[model samples]
Target: MEAEYLRHGVPLADYQLTKADHRRQREAVQVHEWVQRQLAEAPPWSDERWEEMRQLLGSPTPPWELQRWQLRLYCGHVIEATRNRNSPRPDGGVCDKKRCPDCGLDPAVIVAFEPLGPAAEPPAESHSLRSSRSTRQPPADRRSKAELVAENNALRAELEVLRDQA
Candidate 1:
């Protein structure tokens, strides 16, 4: 039987009675074709562009996108203040005294930092699990497994009857 099974390449599962095992198989030829397609479509990153990005980052190390977004916000405020002549600069260039030059506003004006801070820490795995647990409905409060099973059976019977009537 084993020799015949190997010789015919018959799946063993067909001979056995069991629950479904869902698994996907891909051809080697198809995998090779996908690799070729990916290589052809993807563009290589240039060293010059990388260097420019590093300079924009202000340090050799690059900060995360969130930090970059925060810095962008600050720079935008600084740009707006300077353009409007409201920047707090002693020479009226922008606030040199850490306050708005025109309006004497401190927090209202933006101050540019020479170096942007490092990126915030990535969220912990536990936090996500906890959040998901909190958001989900708890298991039904009904008493006894027998009662729940009875209820489920009743519902199924009702559904089957409705389908037959329809």
Candidate 2:
């Protein structure tokens, strides 16, 4: 089944897939390294921000669900694989078969994906201050994309200022 193939790679022989088919399938599920890098560099998730997102989605428990929504906010599809954590790919990455639940979106345009940093680490005073500032805003779901982007830019700027002050 296509779903099974996407969630967990099938043996080429079993599926009668050529190498090219496998390659194409892999590419379909691939998330570029830059996307991962950008996410890695983004600020960690603040407790309030995390809670807010949880509430927005009505608290989906599975990691993939939230991750899928996050990717949608950035790129309009689930570019990254998050399902089946215990089973990784042969290369030690996430299994591509576990990615994007079928919105059938093309890979995200790199330029379209914006990083909204949230604090994952223990907040420095400045970071806490930043969180306090964000707490005043309307909920994320209600905000326009432009507004969110602008706010993110402003937060990044504020963080730079705080870093310089330290």
Candidate 3:
């Protein structure tokens, strides 16, 4: 349900959610904007960077997932109301009721997060380049994060040089 909202980008009022859901969706939108800004300015240096950024931030899922996850966490509990519109309450914790097969809510719930945890995005990714075992190219994953940044800068310089040459 939340995914449909996040994926669609339609206004929250379209979802027919209860008042609490509307508030939660609004909060999610804020989170979504912040996450997008982070994504745009993240390391600016690798395919794996966004994943790493996400790990530092909190979620590997899309902005909407985190938004919905946060909403569910906040709602704690929501009761079945008219026409499948669930009325979530701040108290009582609807987590148990969340188990219904048709409900489709997040399975596990977490409270807090640590700063420098595991890699948000794994290193095994291609940065717009096809993966090849060429000796001229070493996988960016093998290089330290510092090395990758330096390499990126060098590549940018080389690109400028090529453009001037052309």
Candidate 4:
């Protein structure tokens, strides 16, 4: 994953530990600078602002499409004021300041770190049976919009019948 970060926008096939660390640190700094630039052009951040930034970055990969939870790791800032000194952030950095520059939030938070590429895919199909048994929902897209509405109405009627029976 560190290697992925190092090779993001450059032609480095392999880098020494110091070089890799430098690349990651450089990218992190760039992210911060980008945010500052956005804030300069537009004071506060928003979904639209992030979309603009994402478009400018031109990829959904790290240091770009990263969610707020993940952003806290990279930015050392958050929307809400927090002072947890032990909070683990990206690159093993921590910020206990009342006003952190890197903190922000989004509607969705990704709980795990994932590097770009095919390795991000799910585990092998050997556990397909277990996964299948747990998830019984039909694919949502299989039904048309009208079909879904009709099914919802039928389910409501069935629910009312069950209530009356009770």
> Whose TM-score is greatest here?
2
State every prediction's TM-score relative to the real structure. 0.18, 0.28, 0.22, 0.21
lDDT of each: 0.38, 0.42, 0.38, 0.41
**Runs with alpha carbons beyond 4 Å of true place in candidate 4:** 1-17, 43-166
Please give the RMSD of candidate 3 to the true structure: 19.5
What does candidate 2 score on TM? 0.28
State the local distance difference test value for candidate 1: 0.38
Q: What would the per-residue lDDT of candidate 2 be over residues 25-126, giving only the tens digit for each residue?
A: 546446555567789999999999998998898943444212111222112332333332222222124322323355543442211111222213333775
Task: Give the Å shift of residue 1 in candidate 1.
Answer: 58
Give the C-alpha miss distance for residue 69 in model 2, angstroms.
Answer: 22
lDDT of 4 by residue, 12-126 (tens): 2221234544465565556666878887997667899888998898854432223222222223222222111222332224321122344432211211221222323334563
The sequence of per-residue lDDT tens digits that candidate 1 reaches over residues 2-69 is 01111111222223221221111123234546877998998977999888988887844222222211
Ranking by lDDT: 2, 4, 3, 1
Between candidates 1 and 3, the TM-score winner: 3
Q: Which ten residues in a row have the lowest lDDT in candidate 2?
A: 1-10
lDDT of 3 by residue, 43-155 (tens): 66676886787788884333211222212222233222111112122112332223223344333121111111121322444422334434356655697889889999999
CA displacement after TM-score superposition, residue 3 of candidate 2 (Å): 14
Which regions of candidate 1 deviate over 4 angstroms? Answer: 1-108, 111-118, 142-166
- Model 3, position 122, has a per-residue lDDT of 28
